[model samples]
Target: MAKTIFITGASRGFGRIWAEAFLERGDQVVVTSRKGSGLSELVEKYGSAVLPLELDITNRAACFSALEKAKSHFGRVDVVINNAAMGVVGMVEELGEQESRDIIEANLFGTLWITQAALPILRAQGSGHILQLSSALGVYTFPSVGIYSASKFAVEGFSEALSLETKDMGIHVTIVEPNGFSTDFTASTIQSKPLPAYDQVRTALYSNPAMTESDTYGDPKATAAAILKLVDATNPPLRLFLGKKALPLAKAVYQQRLASWEEWNTVAIEAHGL
Candidate 1:
């Protein structure tokens, strides 16, 4: 059965590759981005099968309207990939208040809005998949990217709860955590603020000249393939970690946290009367 997938932020990066991958597999895809021109190109190449909707996911009305349009065009939305996100690279305090808010609105709240709007259609059909494009930072914290991490962390929590909530309802939610992918991410990523105090640390940690100049990370096509597998699987996992570096980092973080908890378990268990 050919699936109809609606993907936001489809103009570029993983979103664009995912859209193409699905199209190649004979699936009808609705590609959306904030700009119409980019979406127009995909529609031109893929024809009617690729429905392009120009939208900013931050707008609630636009989000719901897109869902309605998708339903009208395809009759059913088998999968919804909320891949639209903004990366803010800077210290939280250094970043302007409004900039931080905008990041949250686009990356966190925008995903929430789209998921909420799509629930009705998915529920009506009684089965659907929701894939969230999160980051490895969602699992672990790092300096110089606090704002971006914060948004992704919120998404991680939201997706976890949503997975449990929709599990029984036949709606599957998967969170994709990708590490440094060879995409336009680094070049296109925005810095909310540049603080002199953090310059050395930022240069040492966040500034990867190789990533900026060369495509040495995981392939977006491979990531798309993983997404396809998750979408098609009868029982997909709640979280899909992507890229070579992502899983290791996530594992290390989890282990460290587990050790910390275990180290204090005696006191914790005693307090709880274990």
Candidate 2:
């Protein structure tokens, strides 16, 4: 059965990859880009199979309006991919106040609005899947990318709750956590001014095997088939890690976290007043 998938940020990166995959498989797609640039090829090639929309996901009203227009054009929307978000590269103190806030605004609040916009439509149909593009940093953290990680962390939190809330409505929510990908993700991020004090910290990150290794990044094109299988599953996972890095990183992070929590159990129990 051909499905209609609505995707934000479909002009590039994983969004474009998945959008093309769906179109090639005879599925209808409603693709969005901020300036509406880079979408002409999709229209020219895919014809009516792709509906390109000029959208800013941060605008709540615009998000709702876009979903309505998609439903009107397609007659039904089966999948919604919230792949639009901003990335900021900075150490904790290096980030500007407005820069930190804007990253959160676009990554966390923007995703929230789009998910909110899709809920009503999906609920009405009683069958829909939502894919949120979170990050491996959402599950774990590093020094230089705190603000961006914080935004993704917030997204992971709310998206988990959203999955539970929508399960009864036959709506499936999948939070996609991708590690480093060779998709201009690192190159295209908004970088903050360098603080001389953190030079050593930056150098250490650059020198780390995990950060610099060739295998750390995965090909974005290879992900389309995995996502296609995911949405086709009868029971998909609430959390889907895109590359090999996320699971191993998550395991190490949680092990250390659990060890610390156990070590502090006495204090935690005392503070609980139980």
Candidate 3:
């Protein structure tokens, strides 16, 4: 069955690839970004099968209005893909207050607004799927992108909770954790003021040739196909990871946490009252 799909951050990266993939499969695709620059060719290629709108997910009212417009056009949205986000690179102390707040507003609050706006529509329809685009960093943190990881961490928790809450409502929620792809994410990422003291560590961490190397990046189209398969499943997982690196990284981090928890289990339990 062809679905009515709404995707954010469709101007580029995974969002653009997914939009094209869905439209190619004859699905109704409504895509949005802060600007319409990247959507023009999609509209031309797919004609009425795609609707491109300018959306800034950080604005609650704008999110609501975009969804309303989509509903008005397609009757109802069958799937909502929350893929809009930005990354900021800097150490905790090196990052300014405003930079941290801005990234949080765009990545965390933007996702929240879109999810909130779509919930009522899905509930009223009695069936829908909401796919959240998180990152492997969401499951585990790394240096130089502390704020970005924090934002995705919040997304991971929110999406997991939403999945549990909406499980019986005929609405499905899945958090997607993707590894490095051939996107210009690093180049486009916001950078905080550089500190000389941290320059050596920063270069060592971020300047590695394999970090953002395009030759080894995962395929966006394959990832998009995986997402499509997830939505079509009779019982989808609460969390879906894309790219080979995602699961290994997540599992390793989870195992480390578990090990520490068990090591201190007796002491940790003693602090709690029965």
Candidate 4:
């Protein structure tokens, strides 16, 4: 049976690819972005099965309105993909307070709002899937991407708790953590603060290499395919660490964190009076 999918940030990147993948597979898709123009083009190409919704997930009223519109169009959403996010790159201290707040609003609170709005409809249907597009930063924090990492980490924790809470409610929650992909993400990324101290490092890490070397990042199509596979599976994992770079990084982070915890376990136990 063809399922109804609602995806945010569908103007480009993983969201767009995921929308296309589902449409190809005969699924009904309602793709949304802050601007409707791009999504309109996609709908024009793909026809009615792909509905374009103009939405800014950061707005609570807009989020609810989108959900209502989706429900009206499809009756019920079989899957909800929360892929809308904004990346704030720079040192936490250097980034303006407003920038940090904006990142949280877009990446964390936006996801929460949409998920909350969709839950009731999903619950009424007895079964539904919620997929979150997190990142490798969700598990391992990096130097310049602190705010982005924090948002993703919040998403990781939220998804984990929600998965457990909805275990018996017939609603499935999954988080996809993908490494650097060949998307406009890096190019379109917004830098909250320009620290002169980090100029050389930033250029060396983000700019210079891209110009000298051929891009070897994972393909968005592959990521979309993986998403489709998981969505269609009989039993999907609660958390899926995607991409070649992502898997190893996640494993290493987990192992290192575990070792650190074990090293301090004696002290921890003593503190607890065990």
- Identify the leading candidate in terms of lDDT: 2
TM-score of 1: 0.92
Tens digits of per-residue lDDT, candidate 3, 1-274, equal: 8899999999888898899989998999999989777899998999998989999898999999999999999999999999988888888889999879988998899999999999999999999999988888888877788899999999999988998899888999888888878786764588899889987888888787747566447877788789879878878888877888777767888899999999999998998967
Q: What is the lDDT of residue 95 in candidate 3?
A: 91
Provide the clashing-pair count of each candidate structure. Answer: 0, 0, 0, 0
As a whole number from 0 to 100, the lDDT of residue 7 in candidate 1 is 96
Predictions in order: lDDT: 0.87, 0.92, 0.88, 0.86
Instruction: Give all TM-scores, in the order shown.
Output: 0.92, 0.98, 0.94, 0.93
The regions of model 1 sitting more than 4 angstroms off are 206-216, 266-274
lDDT of 2 by residue, 155-260 (tens): 9999999988888999999999998888955534789999999999999998999988889899999999998998898899999999998898899999999999
Q: Give the distance in Å from residue 54's predicted Cα in candidate 3 to where it truly belongs.
A: 0.8
Q: After superposition, how far is residue 156 of candidate 2 from its true place, in Å?
A: 0.7
TM-score of 3: 0.94
lDDT of 1 by residue, 96-154 (tens): 88778898999999999999999999998899999998988888878778889989999
The number of the candidate with the highest TM-score is 2
Clashing pairs in 4: none
